[model samples]
Each structure stands twice: as C-alpha cells, then as structure tokens.
Target: MTCNLAYNPRFMFLTKTIRYNLLAILACLLWSSSFVTTKHALDYQTPLTLAGLRFVLAGLIQIPLCGHLLAPLRMLRKEFFTVLLVSIFHTIFLYGTFFIGMTWVGGAEGAIMIGVGPLSSALMAHLFMHDDKMQRRTLVSIGFGMAGVVLISLASKPWSPVGLKEFFGLMLLLSGAVVSALGNVVVAKRKGGLHPIALNSAQMLLGGVVLLLIAFPFEGAANFALPPAFYGQLMWLAVISATAFAIWFHLLSKIKVSKLNLWKFLIPLSGATLSWLLLPDESPTLPSLAGMALIVAGIVIGQRESK
Candidate 1:
C-alpha cells in the first residue's frame, strides 16, 4: 500500500493532464465543426444575422441549463467588464470576421486560417501569463506556422496564385483569430472568476444583441421562412457554441493557456478534413495539404519543452 501510494502523485498528474487534454480536444472538435455548418447556413441567411441568431440562441439555451441563473447574474456584478470585453472579441469580432471571410474562401481555407490562432495564442499567452514564456521551440514553431499560413493563402484559390480578395479575406480571418487569442488570455486571467456557464452565457447574450443591432443596420434582415437545412445548421451551431464555449472557459481557468491551446492544432486537421468531405466544391490540393502539414508540424514543435 505504501509503495503504491508513493507513485500516486505521478499517476494523479498524468490523469489530470489526460483529462485536460481530452476536454481541450473536445472543445476544439466542436469548434472545428462550425466551418461546415456555418457554410451551409450562410446560404439562407445574411452573415451577421446568422451569427446573431446562433449566439443569442446559444445564450438562451445555456442560461436555462445553468440550473441557477441568478448565480451567474450575481457573479456578473463583479466580473461584468471582463465578460464584456470577452464578448466583444470572442463572440462579436470573432464571428463577425468569420462570416465575412468565409464569403471569400471555402470552409477548409477558413478553418485553416482560424487554425493560425494558436500561434497568436502562444505569443499572447507569453505576454499575459507568468507560466507561459516564449521559448526557442515556440519561436521555431511560429516561423513554421507562418510559412504554413502563407502556403495556405497561396492555396486559397486552389492551385492558383491567391489574388488580393482572398489575401484580404485571409487577413480578416486571421485578425479574428488574433482577437480571439486576446479573449482567451482575458478568460485565462480570470481563472474562474466567473462560472464557465455564466460567463459563456453572458457573453453570448450580450454579443448576440450587439450583432443583431449591427446586422439590422448594415446587412439587413434575415428570412426566417427557410428550409429545414438552414435551421438545422443554426441549431447545431448554437448547440456546439453553448457546449464548446462552456468547456473552453472551464479549461482556460484550469490549464496553462499556451499549453492548453496546443490542442487547437486539431482544429485545422479536423476542420479541413471535414470540409473536404462535406463541402461540394472543396477538395484536397497540394499547397493546402503541404500547408496543413507544416502547420501541424509547427503545432508538434510548439508542444515541446522550451529546451
């Protein structure tokens, strides 16, 4: 018994690490699915309007399921602004650019572009976190990841030199990713200052409201008289957002932001693969595969210890 207990700490550490990684992977997987779903939904709805509906519905679903809604409300008084800032970047800007950018690129390209997020997250985590520093491996990974992104951009138009439109779109998509990293840093700083459900629900609600306001003025109204496919996509997106954001907030509080984000490497892999399978117009191309390989390699490198 004594000998068994002696190694218990190591076992516990390994268990905890595995659990966290699994949770991170789960969240990233849900996120990766959005590219395909959003693509289908976009056919029936305007960009910002669809985004608004997804988040608002997500928030509505999450808040009720939270069991005690008042608890989140109570918690919000102290952490209101923190959650607000998160909503601005995480929900509004992230989805805003995501919708617009997808118009210019296919689902796979959009997902790969979003995959560039962890590179930015690594840098931001170093700036904001005491435990996460920019190491040689991190630097090396960034170089590789940038190369991957460039390759992906070149491949965006599929076997042709990417024109200014695709380049601009990719940049817009990447900007959302950068702000999203900042948002993750914000959530990490809190370290569970708010309940994950509460925080996610609040941000989604607030962000959804603002998006609807913006959409009405600029993008115009959305038609609810639509096909089952559109509604199905919207429902799935909302479900995933509610579930994934809750998981993400929980993970952000518990794990090192940089280390946890290493799992995001799965996003590009899963997203692109799914896109190729689902989206009619999308298929594997040399530059895209090569770019994904480099990005995955960078993520592998990023996972290494500083030495």
Candidate 2:
C-alpha cells in the first residue's frame, strides 16, 4: 500500500526542503527576467549608468523598509570589512561586468550564459571548502545543467548578435560569473550577526555608488530626466534587486553553497522564456524546449537526498 506522505518523516523533511528551495527559485526567476528588462532599459540609458542607478535606488528603498537605516549603518563599524568585500564582489564586479556584457549580447543569449553560474559556484565550493566536495549527484546535475545551456544556446534567436562583440561580451560575463561565485562563497561563509536584508542594502548602496562614479567618467554626466516609462522599469529592476538579493542572502546563510547553487540552473530556462515572450521578435525554438527540460531534470536530481 502507498504511504501517506503527511505521516512520513522523510517526506515531511523533503517537503520542507522544497519550500526553502522555492524561495531561491523565485529569486532566480526574478533575476532571469532582468535580462529582458535591463535590455529595454538600456535603450534609454548607458549600461553602467542604468545598472548603478538601479541598485542605488534598490539600496535606498531597502534601508528604510528594514525599519531603520541606522542598524545597517552601525554594522559598518563592526562588519565593514566583510561588507566592503561583499560590495566589491557581489555588486561592483558581478553587476558591472554583467551590464557591460549585456551591451554585447541579446537577452536570451546572455541569460543562457548565466546558466553556467551554478557550475562555476560548484567548482569554487569544491576548491575552497573541504567538506563541500563535489559528489556524484553534483556531477550529474552539472552535466545536465551544462547540456541544457548548450542546447538553448544552439537555438537561434532573431536578436542574436554576430562578430567579435558577442565574443567579448560573453568573456566578460564568464569572468563575472567566476568572481560572483566567490561572492556566493563569501556570503555563505562570512555572514555576521547583522540581518541579511541589512547587509544586502549596505553592500548595494556602497557598490552602486562606486558604479555611478565609474559611469560618470566613462558614460558622461548623469541625467535624472527621462520618460516616465523608463522610471517604471528602473523601479521594477530596483525592487528585483532589493527583494531577490535579500532572499538569496538569507538562504545562502543557511544552506551549503554547492547544493544551493544547483538551483540557479533554472535561471536560463526562465530567462529565455521571459525574453521569448516579451521581446517582439523572439520565440522559443526546439533546442530551447529541450534545454529547459534538461534544466528541470537536473534540478530534480539536485534536490534528492545526497551530499
């Protein structure tokens, strides 16, 4: 006879694990749509300027929502070094390279490239943490995840770029992913007593300011004046950053980096879907369908009870 899962301890435990996994999945989904949104926003502003402004607004919005800016401010005295490191890795380098990279590639292609992030994180974890060694399950998941990204990339998009720009852009994004993996390790390892949301806001504010500084010198003077529609997109991007990063950091603090990153394989699947749906000229091709299936299968295996 089939057992009632409600009374099964293993089933209950698995259910709880799935629930937390959903939070990270939600964050990935939000981040995936950013390719579409960021691409659109870039039409109105330079990449660096748009990225800097988005996170700055996100940081400002988050600080007040966390009940007080002062708590995060105070943590600077004690956790300033940690926060600074996070700002550099998580915000500045990660997002900086991402924005610049976006300039060279289409939304769907960029999103697919981002799918490799989990593999990168897994490698980083294996090298850095003694106990976080890659197991058979991780290798299998990585195989599926990498295959999925490859399949999706094979599907041609109308917006796909040709020539050297795309190559350079992808290289930058790859570099960003490598360093961003390190940021994940740092967040999981070095999170202090400060609340995750507070830490997220502080790091974002600092990094956003630095990005803005870099933008001014390279992209010319900033202009707050823009169409109201552009501001709407900016606000949505900010909300994505504020909410998703908070959820991500909170989960990172509790979960093992190697396993947690496995869920990021869903990013390209969701990102490509959003792009295909939202972009006027884009549509899902056969390879994309196959790719998404592989990503789903990989994530399912990743969630199994294994080290």
Clashes of each: 0, 0
* Tens digit per residue, CA lDDT, model 2, 179-251: 9899888888864556888888989988898999999989997787899989999999999999999999998
Clashing pairs in 2: none
Model 1 Cα lDDT, one tens digit per residue, 1-307: 3568446897887777779778888998898888767877888899999999999999988877677867556545777898789999899999988888888875446656766787789889998888878677777777776677667655655444578888888888989989999999999988856678988988898898889999998887768899888888999999999999999999999987776777777776676677678779878789878988887788678765443
Candidate 2 — what's its lDDT?
0.84
Runs of candidate 2 exceeding 4 Å displacement: 1-12, 156-162
Predicted candidate 2, C-alpha RMSD? 3.0
| Best candidate, TM-score | 2
CA displacement after TM-score superposition, residue 75 of candidate 2 (Å)? 2.2
For all predictions, the C-alpha RMSD in Å is 2.9, 3.0
- Cα error, residue 74 of model 1, in Å, equals 3.3
Per-candidate TM-scores read: 0.86, 0.91
Model 1 misplaced stretches (Cα beyond 4 Å): 1-7, 107-112, 142-165, 279-297, 304-307
